[model samples]
Target: MDVLGQLVAVPTVNPPGESYGEMVEVLHSIMEDAGYEVSAVEVPRDYLERYIPQHADHPRYVVIARVGSGRPVIHFNSHYDVVPPGEGWSRDPFRLSVEGDLVYGRGVVDMKGGMAAAILAAQAAAMAGAGDFGTVELSFTPDEETGGETGVKYMVEAGLVSPDYVVVPEASGSGNVWIGNKGNLWAEVEVRGRQAHGSTPWLGLNAFDGMARLAVALSEELNSMLSSRRSSYPFADPREAAPTVTLGGAVSGGAKVNVVPGRYSFTVDRRLIPEEGLEEAERELREALERASAPLRSAGYSVELRVTSRSPPSVIDPRGRLASALSDAVREVTGSPPRLTVCPGGLDTRYFQLAGVEALTYGPGDDSYAHAADERNSVSEMMTVARVYALLISSLLSCPGGPPRSTSS
Candidate 1:
C-alpha cells in the first residue's frame, strides 16, 4: 500500500509531461530489489526536445523484467501516464489518502493501482519459487492518455512486444472483463458564408444558421441510423446498445452580435461497431454532412470536413481461450462470474488486437473515477486483483502448451 501510495503521489500528467522520470526510477528500483533484470527504454530525442517533452521523444521506455526465456511468454503491459485531473475534488488530488478501504488519488484507479497489483503478483510468484513455464514479462510504458502516438504504438512498431498473449490492466471495474472496445472517429466541419450586418441579414449569408441546419439534419439522421443498427456487448446495458454520433464542439465566425457570421466550425464524435472500418465510417459521415450542407452551398456558402482522429473498432471472441482464462481467473479469485463487456471508448487494446495478439483489459477499480478529481481505488479490490493476477499467471503456466483454457458457457 505504501508503494502504491507513493506511485499515486507522483504526478505523471501527460500534456506537459508528469514526473515520469521519478516514477520510472521508483518502479525500476522496486523490480530490481525483487530480483528482476530491469532496463529502461528511452523516448525519442526529437519528441523530448519539443514542448511536450514526454511525447516529443516518442519514447518507448519499457521496464522489462523476465523470470525465464522461451515461448509461451506471458506479457503484462500498462501505461505509466495519466490524464490531467479534471475539476471537482474534496481532497488533494495528488495525495493518496486512505479512508477505510479506499485509496484516493489521481491515477490510483485509472491504472497505477493495476500496475502495483501486477508487480506484487509477480513478486509473490517469484518468492514462492514458481518456476517459470516460459518467461513472464512486465512492460511499463508512458503516454496512454491524450491518445498521444507514443507509448504502446511505438513499442509494437519497434518490435518490443511480441508476447503470445498480452494483458493490459486497464480499468474494467471489479466484475468485468473487457473483450473489446468501440472505435472512434473525430472530424471537424467548417462552413464558409458571406458576412452581412445583422440589420440586413438578407444581404449576408449566416454561417451559424447554415451550421444549425446541418446540426439538426445530422442529429435526425444519426438517431435513426444508430437506432436501426443496435448491437449489444454482454456487459453493456441493452437499452444503450448502439453506435452514436455526437456534436462535440462548435465555433462561430463573426465576433459581434450585430454581424452575421461569415464562418462556422463544428466537431463530430462518432463511435463505430466492429463491422465498420474507420475509412468506411468517415466516408459515410462525410457523405451525410455534404448532403446536408448542399442546400447551404446553393445559397452561397461552402462546407468542408476534416478528420481529426480515426481509431478502428476491435473485438475478441468472448468464448476464446484467452477470454476464458481471464474469466476463470476472475471467478476463482472473486468468487463471482465476471460480466464480459465491450469498452464504450477506445484504448490501447485495439493496438494489440490489430497486431494479431490475443489481448484483454481487466483490472480492479471504479472506472467512473478516471480523470475526475479525487480519483480512487479500493484497497480490497487492489489486493483482490493481485491475487487474481497471480492465479491467472499460474493457470496459464500450468496449462500444457500454455494455451488459453475454454470459458464456461
Candidate 2:
C-alpha cells in the first residue's frame, strides 16, 4: 500500500508525458532496494521526432530491473502512464486515498496498482530464494494509454530485454487471464462538394448526401463481409470474439444551415478479431469505399480515404506453458480456475507477441474502472495478484522435472 501510494502520487499522465522522469526514479529506487540490478532506458529524441513529434520535448523512459541470470527468463511488465483525469472526482486524483481496503487515485485501477503488485511479487520471490532456478525481469514503461510506440515497442526493437515468457499486468479483471487483445484500424473518409444556397440544391453537389450514401454502403458491405468472420479465440464477451466497426465516432460538415455542405468527413473505428490481419482489413475497406463512391464521383463529388492508424491483432496459445502456469497460480491463490480469454481492446502484449515471444495479461482491479472517474482498486485484490505472481515466478523458475526450457530463439 505504501509503495502504491507513492506511485499513485506521482501522476505520470502521458499526453504531454508529465513526470515520467520522477516516476522512473521512484521505480528505480524501489527496484534497487529490493536487490535487483536496475536501469533506466530513455527513448531517443530523434526516434521520438520520427515517431511521435508533438511530445518530443517531454521525453520517455522505461525502467528495467533484473534478478538472477540465464535460461527460462520470466519478464513482468506494466506501464506507469495514466490517462488524463477528465472529470468528476471526489478528491484530488493525484492523492491516494485509502478507505478500508479500497484505494482511490487516477492510475490505481488502470495500472499503477498492478505495477506495485508486480514489484512486490518480484521482491517476495527473490527474498524467498526463488531466483536460483532462473532469471526474472521487471519493466515499468510509459505511453500505454496513448499506444506503446516508445515504450514496449521500443524496448523490444532496441533489444533491451528478451524473455521466454512475459506477463503484462494489465488487469484482465475478476481473476481472469487475458491471452490476447483485439487490433484496430482507424480511418477517416472525406466527401468533397461545391457549396451553394440551400434554396438551389441542384446547383451544388451536397457533400452530406454523398457522405451519407458512402457511410450506409460501407456499413452494409462491411457488415456482410464481417458477418461470417469470427475469431476462434475465447473472449469474456462473445461479441468481442467477432470483428466490429463503429462509424462516425467523429464527424464534421457544413457551416450554415442555409448553405449546401461543401465538405464532410467521419472517422471509422474498425476493430479486428485476432484472426484478422491489418492489411486485408484496410484493403477491404478501401475497395468498398471505392466501389461505393463510384456513382458519387460521376456526380461531381470527390471522395478521399485516409488511414490514420493501424495495429495487428495479437494472441497466444491458451494451452501453452505460460498460460498453464498462470492458470495454476490463479487457481492456487484464489481457488478458482481463471477463464482464459482475450481483451476487447489492444495491449502492450501485442509487442511481445509480434516479436514471437509468448506473452499474457493478468493483474488486479475491474477493467471497467480503468479510465473512469474516482478510479480505484481493492488492496486485497492487489495483494491477491501479488501472491499469484510470486507463485507463478516460483513455478516457472523452480519447478523440478517440468517442461524443459527452450534454447531456441
Give the top-scoring candidate (TM-score).
2
lDDT of 1 by residue, 342-367 (tens): 88887787788888888999887988
- In terms of lDDT, model 2 sits at 0.89
Q: Write the per-residue lDDT of candidate 2 for residues 305-376, one digit (tens) a residue.
A: 999889988898998989998999999999999999989898999999999988999989998998999998
Count of backbone clashes, every candidate in sequence: 7, 0
Stretches off by above 4 angstroms in model 1 are 45-60, 196-203, 250-259, 403-409
Q: Model 2 off-target regions past 4 Å?
A: 196-203, 253-260, 401-409
Distance from true location, Cα of 114 in model 2, Å: 0.8
In model 2, the number of clashes is 0
